[model samples]
Target: MTSIFYLHGGPGMSVAVERTRYPQAQEVHWWQQPPATSCAPHPYLDLLEAALVEFRRSVKERGAPMTVMASSFGAHLATHLAQHAPESVERVVLLAPTYNPEQSALRLARRALALHAGHADADKVTAALAAYDAAPGRARFWEVFGALQLLPDVPALYFGPQAGDAPRHFVEVLQQPGGFDGVSAVAISDDFAATFRTPGRSAFNGPVSVLFGRHDPMIDAEHDGPIWRAIFPQASLRMVDSGHFPLLETSLEACLA
Candidate 1:
């Protein structure tokens, strides 16, 4: 039996949502990165590297070859893990991954920073994030943030109307004091861009699978689908009926099969 590690998206999400999807796995490990702290650096890749170190330690302790199932931003980290530590991972599954930060929600976030910060001052970006964190309802922020991150017409995928509740829960459990600042730094950093290009095709020595919703608004099938296919020639590509977060709507058993 293979041990599976599930990675959640964003800088603030908990492992709870992902854990529920794979109840039957032999063992399920959820990757929890450091919380968003105002004092912490904003660049996400740095945080992601720290998470990878933890993941390697966890994998060693489990004594089982790992299978990684990651969604959205989590997928980005998973890709890096597979690239750098291929021997520890047996298989990879990426759900609605947005590898090209320039095309997805990160771009919107950059634009938002430009609008609010005037000239990309790190302090201003941090302040704006802090304000969003201090907002009364955390879930509302998640929903708004999700909408900004995902494509417009695909609210059902990332957040159904009920998603408001999710963000609230997320805020309660995952919101650290400096989380917003950390995420902002990561979103705007050039290091992430450089990492994306370098990991091109040699990242994984095992089979890789990618699942995406046909209606996914944030990631265009026409663009990303072909790129993935080309990159992972040995990979399997599945298109589901749902949007960005397909695991929320589709069964993990079916997806794994």
Candidate 2:
């Protein structure tokens, strides 16, 4: 039997909400990247690939490939892993994967501003963008990205209203000590953002499933969907009515389907 692994986004975000979606009868390995502090310099890609390679080797069937389901930043890492160690991954599921970090951030910023129009905290979005404009550093870029996408008033931006308690669970996960900051560190890593700017395609020829939220404020599906389809010709792309957290926003069965 092929093992299933879940890689949560945020680099430091909790898997609490993600874990709840799996059926009790199924065994799925939840792989959480250590807080960005521990794996500095080459936060997501390098560190995660190495660990996954080792884990695949140590598994019951030595080096047996597994199915990898990853979201957001984790999806970014998963794509690289499938390419670097194609032997270790049998299947790939990407949920709202970030194709180009820079583009995605810009989209989020614009969406945030548009969504917050006339709202009192609208100034906050402007301020965040201003910070990035003044010093277009990776760190500031993420601050602006967060300001736009992770705004306290916009739970619907990620988990739509249909997701009962999911938005609250996500907030609780971020509230964990060092959670939000840790993700920031990964986003700000010197090379992390650059790597995803234009990751053309993956060499992994296995089955690939790409899920995008229609309401996602991150990447523009209409634009990136074709890019992803080109990346994996055999990929099955589905756009669902939800936000960034498709796993949490929709039923597990629907998401998997």
Candidate 3:
């Protein structure tokens, strides 16, 4: 049987619920991206290095390439891994992968701006986006973008077409220490994007499946679908009926199918 590896999002988002979906898959529980709160930087390189080590070990144990299933930032990491060590990855399943943090944030901000147009928080969204634009460095960008989670209207943007009823397990994970902050910390790292090599699209021609939620505005499928398709030439895009957390909102069978 092919080894399966699961990578969760949030630079530090809890995988308690996500892990359940891939119970048998190998997971990289990043020590650098811990759940506890801290001021220290959780650089992307740190997590990437650790994950690479874990991935290599999994490959060695199975004596073959492994299938990678990742979500959000985890999906981003998986893509990077495919580029960095494509030989170890046989296939990839990306769930709402965030290719560019700045672009993703901008998309979400624009959506939030529209959603809260008449609401009291409309100005807040605009101001946040403005702050992000004026920010001098990646660190400031993450700082500004991360603060969006605090807005009363921002949470609703992640849900799908159904009522915005988030899973209880997911809600608790976000509330965890460092859960949200780790995201900014990792993205703020100077080497977040610059350190990685940008390989050509032909680098990894493995089978790829990209899943997106129909109502997911945070990483809108409409904007990113084409990008992912171009990046992974063999990628097959699917628009599911759930939100950002597809496994939590929709059945795993449907998502995997």
Name the best candidate (by TM-score). Answer: 2
* Tens digits of per-residue lDDT for model 2, 14-58: 666566555462646765555554535666556566556645654
Q: In model 1, which regions exceed 4 Å deviation?
A: 20-26, 36-42, 106-198
Per-residue alpha-carbon lDDT of candidate 3 for residues 87-130, written as tens digits (9 for 90 to 100):
88888888878777657766777776676677665676577677
Better TM-score candidate (2, 3)? 2
TM-score of each: 0.66, 0.81, 0.78
User: Which candidate, 1 or 3, would have the higher lDDT against the true structure?
Assistant: 3
**Backbone clashes under 3 angstroms, per model:** 10, 0, 0
Candidate 3 versus the native: TM-score?
0.78
Give the alpha-carbon lDDT of every model.
0.62, 0.70, 0.68
Ranking by TM-score: 2, 3, 1
Stretches of candidate 3 off by over 4 Å are 20-42, 118-121, 131-143, 163-165, 177-190, 193-198
Q: Which prediction has more favorable lDDT, 2 or 3?
A: 2
Question: How many residue-pair clashes does candidate 1 contain?
Answer: 10
lDDT for 116 in candidate 2 is: 68
For every candidate structure, what is the RMSD over all alpha carbons to the true structure, in angstroms? 8.9, 3.3, 3.9
lDDT of 3: 0.68
Q: Which candidate is the best by lDDT?
A: 2
